[model samples]
Target chain A: MLVCRDLVKSYRNKTAVSGISLDVEPGKIYALLGPNGSGKTTWMKIVAGLVKPTSGTITYNGEPIGANTKRKIAYMPTEPFFYDYMTIANVGKYYQDFFDDFDPNRFEELIKQMDLNMTDKAKSLSSGLAAKLKIAATLARKAELYLLDEPLNGVDIIARDHVITAILEAANENSSIVLSSHLVDELEKIIDNAVFIKDGSMVLCGEAEKIRAERGKSIVDLYKEIYA
Target chain B: MFKLMKYEFRKQLLSKIVILAMVGILELMFIYGVIAEKANTVASAVGFFMVLAFISIMFVSFECAFTYSKDLKTKQSYMLFLTPNSAYGIVGAKVLTTIAQVFLTGVVFGTVIIANILFMAAKYHSVKEVIEVVQQFFKEAMQLDIQMDLIVSLLVYMLVYWILLIVIAMFAITLTYTFLANAKFKELVSIALFFLILWGVQKIAEFILPDLAHITSYIMLGATGIYLVLTALFYLGTAWMLDKKVSV
Candidate 1:
C-alpha cells in the first residue's frame, strides 16, 4: 500500500507534477492513464525515490520512501537504463546482487520466454527487445509494489501479450502493480483500477468496474472523453 | 557496502586493465633490457615507465570522479540510485574503491622500481654504491637530510595527500552536479569549486602550522594529520549532498 499527498515537482520554469494526490492498495493493478508529459513518470519517480518532490509527502505502509521501501518497490523506467556493457545475463546478475527478493531463476525463465538470448548485449538489443528486457527484469523481482513507467511502449504487438502475461504473473494477493501507458485498450481488460491524469493533475480515479458502470463507458472511452 | 564496492570496481575494470597491461609491458621491457645487458634499452624502459606512472596516477586519481559526473548526467545513474543502497553507502564505496585502487597501483610501481634497482645493482655489482648514490641525489636535490625513516614517512604522507586529492575532487564534482546541474557552464563551475576548496584547505593548513617551509618530521606528521582530517570532512560533505540534494 502507498500514499501520496499534495505531491508537486517543479523544474526551472515548469512543474512536472502539481498538487496530485493518490492512494494505492495491495492486490490490484493500477493504470496511470495520461498522455506524454502528464507527470505520470515524475510521480512514479517520486514514489520510487529517484526524484525529490518540491513539496509533497509519499509513504509506503507508513514509512517514507527510502532504501527500506526501495527494497519492496520495484520501478521500471521507460528508458533503457542498463549499463552499456551489460549482457542480458549480466543485467540479471546485477538485479540479483542488488535486490534480495530478486529471483535469478525467474529472471532466466522470463528472459527465455521473451525470446531473448542470454549473451546478447543489452546495448545492441532492438527497442522492442529492450522493452521486454526491462519488463522481464522488473517482474522477476518479488516486490510488494511494482511501478512500471510505460512498460508496454515500444513492445511489438506479438510480444505485447507476453509482456502483459509476465506482468500479471508478477501480481499476487500481496503485491500491487502500477503501470502507465497510452494504450488504454490493451490495459483496459487487465487493470483493476483506472487513474486518469492530465496536465499534471488527477482528472479521474476509481475502481475500473465501478467507473465503467457508473459512467456507462469503458476505460478507453473515458480516456478519450477526458483527454480529447 | 562491499557489494557496492564490488560493482564500483567492476564499472572501472576496463580502465584498470588498460593501466595494468601497459605497466606489465613496461616491466617486461625493463626485465628484458636488464638480462640483455643493453643500457640504452634499460634507460628507455625506465624513462617510459616514469611517464606512464605520472599518467597512471592522474587517471587513477580522477577516474571515479569522472565516472560520478557521467553517472549523474546520464540515465546510467538509475542503475545505482535504484538499488536499496543509501547515498552514504554508495559514496562511501566509491571513495573506498578509489583508495584501494591508488594503494594497489602504488604497490605495483613500488615493487617494480625496487626490483629494477636491485637488478641493476646486481648487474653492476655495486649495491652499496647504488644506495650511496640515491642518498646523495636526495640530499643534494631536495636540500634535506636523507634517512630511511624520513623516506618511509614521506611515502606515507604522499598516500594521505593522494586520498585528500580524491576526496576534494569528489566533493567539488558533487557540488557542481547538485547545484549547477542544469547550468550551461557546469565544467567551469566544477573546476572553480575544486580550486576554491583546494585553496581553502591550503589556507587552513597555513593558519594551523606556521613554519611550512622548513623540512622536519614533526611538520610532515602534522601536515599528514591535517590532510587526513580534511579528507574525511570532504568525504562526509560529499555524501551528505548526495543524500540530500542529488537527483538523477
Candidate 2:
C-alpha cells in the first residue's frame, strides 16, 4: 500500500506536479491516465523514491519511503533504463544481484515468451522489443509494488497486448501494480482502478467499473470530457 | 558496495584492456630503442611518456564525462538512483573505478620504464654508476635528504599524488558533465558556463589562499590534502545535485 500527501514537484519556475494526493492498495492495477506532461511520471518517480518532491511527503504502509521501502517497490521508467552494452541475460543478472526477490528463471521465461534473444544487447533491440524487455525485467522482480511509466508507448499493437498480458501475469494477490499511459482503451479492459490526472491534479479516481456505472460514462469518455 | 564495484569493473574492463595494451606497446618501443643504443631513445621515451600522459588523461576524463552525461541524456540514471543503494555508493563506484584504472596504468607504465632502465644499465653501465646517477638526480631535483627512508616516503607521496589527480579529474568531469547533460543549450552555453564556474572557483581559491608556487614540498603535501578535500566536496555536490535536482 502507498500514500502520497500534498506531493508537488517543480522544475525551476514550471510546476510538473502540483499538490496531488492518493492512496494505493494491494492486488489492484491502478491505471494513471494523463496527457503529456500531466505530472503522472513525476508523481510515480516521487512515489518510487527516484526524485525528491519539491514539497510534501510520501509514505508506504505508514512510513516514509526510504531504502527499506525502495527494496519493496519496482519502478520502470519511461525510457529504456538498462545500459546499452547489457544483454537481456545481464539485465536479469543485474536485477538478481540488486534485489534479493528477483527471480532469474522467471525473467528468462518472460524473455523467452516475448521472443527476445537473451544474448542480444539492449541497444540492438527495436523500440517495442526494448520496451518489452524493460517490462519483463521489472515484472520479474517479486516486489510488493510495481510502478511502470508508459510501458506501452511506441509499442506495436500486437506487442502492446503481450506487454499488458505480461504485466497481468506478473501481478499477485499481495502485490499492487501502477501503470501510467495515455492509451486508455488498451488499459480499459485490464485496470481494476483508474486515476485520471489533468494538469498535475487528479480529476477522478475510483474502481474502473463502478466509476463508469456511477458516472454513466466510460473512462475514455470521461478523459475527453475532463481534458477537452 | 561490492556489487556496484563488480558492475563498474565489468563496464570499464574493455577500456582498461585497451589502455594496458597501449602502455605495453609504448614500453616495448622504449626498451627496444634503449637496448639498441640509439641516441634518440631517451627523446623517444620522453615523447612516449608525453603521449601516454595525454592518452591517460583524455581517456579517463572523456570516458568519465561521457558516462555521466549519457546517464542523464538517456535517462539511465533513473535506473541507478532508483535502486535501493545510497548516492554515495553510486558515485563512489565511479570514483573508485577511475582511480583503479589510473593506478593500474601508472603501475604498469612505471614498472616498464624502470625495468627498461635497469636492463639498459645492466648491459651498458655498472650498477654503482646507475645508483649514483639515481641518487644525484633525486638529490638535485628534490633538494631532499636522499636516504632509503626518504625514498620510501617519496614513493608514498607519489602514490598519493596519483590518487589525488584521479579524484580531482573525476570530480571535475562529473560536475561539468552533469550540468551540461541536463541543460537546454548544448553547444557553447553549457560549456561556457562550466568553464566560467571552474575559473571562478579557481580564482576565489587563489585569492583566498597563499601562493602555492613558493611553498615547500612538505607544505605542498598539506595543500594537496586540502585539494583532496575540495575534490571530495565537489563529488558530494555532484551526488546531491543528481539525487535531488536533476529529473530523468
User: Interface RMSD, all models, one decimal each?
Assistant: 0.9, 2.2
DockQ of 1: 0.81
Compared with the true structure, what per-residue lDDT tens digits does model 1 show for residues B1-248?
98888888888889888988998898899889989988898899999999988888789878988888887788989999999988888888998898888778878888888887888789879999888888888788989656877787788888898889888888988898877777777778888889899999889988898875566778888989999999889988988888777877
DockQ of every predicted complex: 0.81, 0.52
Structure candidate 2, residue pairs in collision: none
Worst 10 contiguous positions by lDDT, candidate 1 chain A: A49-58
What is each predicted model's overall lDDT from 0 to 1? 0.90, 0.77
CA deviation > 4 Å runs, candidate 2: B27-46, B57-66, B118-212, B215-218, B228-236
Q: Write the per-residue lDDT of candidate 1 for residues A4-69, one digit (tens) a residue.
A: 999998888789999988999999999999999899999999998888888988899999988899
Model 1's TM-score against the true structure:
0.94
In the range B186-247, model 2's lDDT, one tens digit per residue, is 53454565566556555655665567445456545654565566667767776776556555
Q: Which portions of model 1 show Cα errors greater than 4 Å?
A: B118-144, B147-153
lDDT of 2: 0.77
Docking class of 2: medium
